[model samples]
Target: MTTWHCLSVKPEELRLDTTLNCGQSFRWVNTGDNQWTSVLSGRIITLRQTDDDILYRTPDDNVGHVEEVLRDYFQLDVDLGELYKQWRTDANFEKKAGRFMGIRILRQDPVENLFTFICTSNNNIQRITTMVNKLCQHYGTEIGTIYEVSKPFYTFPTVARLAHEDVENELRQLGFGYRAKYISQTARYIMEHHDETWLRGLRNLPYEECREELLKLAGVGPKVADCVCLMSMDKPGAIPVDTHVWQIAKRDYKLSGLASKTLTQKNYLVIGDRFRTIFGTHAGWAHSVLFTADLRQFEHRLISSEETKSNVVLEGTKREVSQARRPKKTAGVTVFDRYPRRKRQILEGKHGIVEKK
Candidate 1:
């Protein structure tokens, strides 16, 4: 039987259905009765919210400080109330806040965010979720299972694991399509030429520099890099403009030239800067909420019916790529496979951290 640890939280502060499945992180699966389960940072964790608190569960007995883990992962420290207040200053934000209230950006592992967003290129949420799950099932260590799906849960695969495995062809066979090569090459480059330190170090750099460095990887581009920046790294100002957001820029913000269709590199920057001007330092979070609401409202009208949300797509950015075959195996641990200790200081940023009494 799975053991659960409970953490008290205000009901008004968050809604699990909106936050978890809003198309940010893909691992968590909704089992039933509002409960969600996933293998995060190598441990199989499950959670659900009641009227007064959030309940977290895990099959592993040694999982320490579950409350702290939830705090960090959900970023409960960041004040959504204050953010909503700030965002409501804009008329459009005020109108949409009620419908999408309580949506929060997850603080996911940077490595996972990088690959996940890379897989996001020209893809939809369902396929992206499937690809990520496949990476975990094929290469990640098995953790446990949830009732919603028959397959046992597995941790997200690490760079070393994907780098060493015959991942490209395997991923192609698994229906990753063209993204299989991008995932394979990105993993190989990380394992061969860099380390986790290099990737995490990008966090400390300026957003522009970090985006540039990330673009050097096989399939990473402006949208993917900015996603890793805003979602994982501490830069909340990073606005990842995709087709949905682009339509928003035109329809809502009335940013001209976007109506002709397609996100050019120039228009991408213009839209991003316009959002920063409107939402201030935390434009990325604002973008997330707006995009979430936009996506929910405009589900059928999206560029591709399969398209979910997140990141940008430059019209002239696609380039030809050499095909990668399966490579020989080696032994090592991946960053995603190893769970690290939680940080003591949560980023309170605009609002002070609040704990349930």
Candidate 2:
């Protein structure tokens, strides 16, 4: 076991539970006990959080500069608390974002971010995660397994590896669907015409120029290009307005007088510009907090006062009643029982109510 080192960050400033799984980067696995494990760069890292610190460890002691890596990956230098204060000035943001603190934009590798998001076009988080894992397992360099979990992790594949002739067919076989061609063509284009440095060099360009360059890639549309721009290429103002965001704009922001109901190319740009206007320079970062609030999987986090009282009752019951004899149904249906099994587990875990089995 490696020595666990502490990174001092308030839970309000950075919540691992919310930020890691909030549809930004898809590789993190919730391995129970509030610890998330994933392969970042080439290192297998495990992280757990406390009230005032984030504890991180690697498989061994030789992983030099792990702290720096964590700081960069989590973008810890940016003051999220200050941003939250600023965003709260907007009534909509203040209303929705009360529980959704500590959400930060990850500074991902441009290469990895580009290809992984290529797989994300019109895809859900679960499927996108599966495709990205498959890509890494097949082509990426084998990083070692986690200590007790025994599951091996791999680095995101290099451009050369993903650029091979057989990669597209292999990806299709691995259930990449139509995204196989995009990944293959994008990889080959980069490998042939540009190097990883050139791709990363876009970080130095203005947001529009950076986005324009990304749009030249095979799989990159406006949304994908903007995703890369904001997430990887250091453009915090670039908002990728998908259907969810379009609804957010129309419903919450009351954006109207548009020509079409559908999110046209023109409307997409309009919505992004509107958000940038509302949230200022780090509008994309502010957009992520609201976006996470709207996700179904995270609805359990938004606990109400009534629910909290119910949870208190449930806790009291759990203590008074024996584990085996405890009533499965509290009142009509217990709070935990209302959610799906997976979300129930998450809620139960959060409330410190252990499952019977």
Candidate 3:
């Protein structure tokens, strides 16, 4: 095993639990004992955290500059603590972000981030994660596995591999559904017209221009483009408004004049612009904290201290408290049932579906 190294970061500044699983990047696998393992930039890396540090290691010493790779991937140069302090100035942000800290955005590979988010159309995080893993398993190069995980990890596929004629059928067989064609066509488009270098170069472009470039690709709508822009392209101001954000805007901020039922394109721009007005340049990052807080999976964290104490019972001299389980239903609706019902339309002669708002 490679020797473990430390990257100093406070718990309040970075929490792997929230950052890894909060519907951002979906490649990380939690391998018990607080360790997360994944194939990043063609290498297998494992990470664990303490209250004051992030501990990382690889399978062997051959993986040079592990620290550099991690620093870049995690965007450690940015001070999340300072950003938190600024975001807390807003009452709504302060309320929702109380239980959520250390939720920094991961600067992922553009190719992986783009294609992974293409799978996110009208989909949930769990399903998106499965599709990304299946894509890697089918087309990516095999990287050696860690002992903690039984299955071998693989590098994300190159554009050439995913652009192959058989990729769409293979992805459909692996259960990608309509997203299969999007992935294949986008891959082929990039390989034929633009390359990975060209895609990554968008990071240097202005935010709006970068988004425009991404919108020209197959299956990349306004939301997906914003997602790619924020997560991969150097666009911290890019806020990708989805159902959760739309609700948060109307319910929390009390922004009026919103469409009563659906999130229209006009409403989408309105929400993103509103968040930018509230949270400043890094509105996307701040929006993520609130978005994570609203997720049903994280609802248990919002329980007040008094609520936890109330759940406790005195049994003679021994005090026992029941563990908190994730709620099966929220407000009379099943968790998945609450997802927005999107209407998928087939654009004539296009390989992808247009999701009507």
lDDT of 3: 0.79
Candidate 3: residue 45 Cα off by (Å): 0.6
- lDDT string for model 3 (295-340, tens) is 9988877766555533422211122222443222212211111125
Cα lDDT, model 3, residue 141: 84
Residues 236-277, model 2: lDDT tens digits = 999998888888888898887554767898889889989999
User: Can you give the lDDT of residue 132 in candidate 3?
Assistant: 91
Clashing pairs in 2: none
RMSD values for the candidates in order, in angstroms, are 14.5, 8.9, 14.0
TM-scores of all predicted structures: 0.80, 0.85, 0.85
Q: After superposition, how far is residue 249 of candidate 2 from its true place, in Å?
A: 0.5
* Model 3 regions more than 4 Å off: 307-357
- Regions more than 4 Å wrong, model 2: 307-357
Tens digit of lDDT per residue, candidate 1, span 20-54? 87778988887655578886667777776543346
Judge candidate 2 at residue 36 and give its lDDT: 89
